[model samples]
Target: MRFSVNKSEKYTVLVPEEEKLDSLKAPQLKAEIVTMFQSGTENLIIDLSSVKYVDSSGLSSILVANRLSTEVNGKLVLAGLNEHVMKLIKISKLESVLELHPTVQEAIEAIFLHEIEKDIEGEED
Candidate 1:
């Protein structure tokens, strides 16, 4: 998979435009996801605006990314999912595990808002 990262004061955005079509190196993709997490970004927003089709292996990679992000108390939000990709996520039952936003702006706001809510919850506790 290829990605470009942009960091604002609030969060880091990873825009993954293309993914490996084959199932090989799925583990490697997972490793890369972990690397992105360790890249010192707090909240993460993954823009899937350019992604076309995501297979089972790709879904696995995304799950790993989500897990890594949550481990570090960060948000992993997906934006601009195409119809086919959305179907794949729905069929895989991954929609429940991941957050979906219609636009990049919405995803960014949701991620930051989620973090703020988490912080508030932590403070309350």
Candidate 2:
């Protein structure tokens, strides 16, 4: 539940400070993501560099964020995942479903690129 949030015009970066993202913290994380979406945050970047462990509930929270982002035609990005967490996501077969980046900066760039793509598609329409 302990985290830092950096808000920008286009996206928000949420960095959970916990080492373990398990059932105990997953609910809070889900609630936070929902609240951000309700508050009109279309794009989100979750920086998981500090987290070394995660459970199914933790992955569920991330999935919730992705669903919300899709609902708003936005982007959900994960960054700085450690090896263990990455393996867990891959094992869950979520690597193909989610956007993963090596750093927050790269994630931000991806979001911007996604926005540009959307804009181009809109213009084409």
Candidate 3:
């Protein structure tokens, strides 16, 4: 459950320090994601560079974050996933459901692009 959070006006980056993301840590991560959304953080990037492993619960937590972001018309981007983690997500057929980025910077850029698209769509209305 140990993580670091860096917040900006546009989005927040959450980096879990744990090497393994399992049932024991998933709930805490879920809670943190919920808290951030409740506090008006719409866009989020989860940097998983340090995490080498993930279980079903961990994937569930990530799904919850994606659901919350979708509910608010925001974006949830997962970044820095290692090969093992990426393989698991692909195996689960979640690679299409989740936004994956190779780097946090790329994820941040994506969030910005999403915001721009939203802005454009709003202007059309």
Backbone clashes in model 3, listed as residue pairs: none
Query: What is the C-alpha local distance difference test score of each model?
Result: 0.79, 0.98, 0.97
Return the lDDT, model 2, position 30: 97
lDDT of 3 at 4: 99
Among residues 3 or more apart in sequence or in different chains, the pairs in candidate 1 whose N, CA or C atoms overlap within 3 Å are none
Q: For every model shown, what is its TM-score relative to the native structure? A: 0.86, 0.99, 0.99
RMSD of each: 2.1, 0.5, 0.5
Judge candidate 1 at residue 69 and give its lDDT: 79
Off by over 4 Å in 2: none
For model 2, where is the 10-residue window of minimal lDDT? 87-96
Q: For model 2, how many clashes?
A: 0
lDDT of 2 by residue, 1-125 (tens): 79999999999999999999999999999999999999999999999999999999999999999999999999999999999999999999999999999999999999999999999999999
Top candidate (lDDT): 2
**Across residues 31-81, which tens digit of lDDT does each residue of candidate 1 receive?**
766876777766777777887777888788878778887888888888888
| Better by lDDT, candidate 2 or 1 | 2
Off by over 4 Å in 3: none
Model 3, span 1-125: residue lDDT tens? 79999999999999999999999999999999999999998999999999999999999999999999999999999999999999999999999999999999999999999999999999999
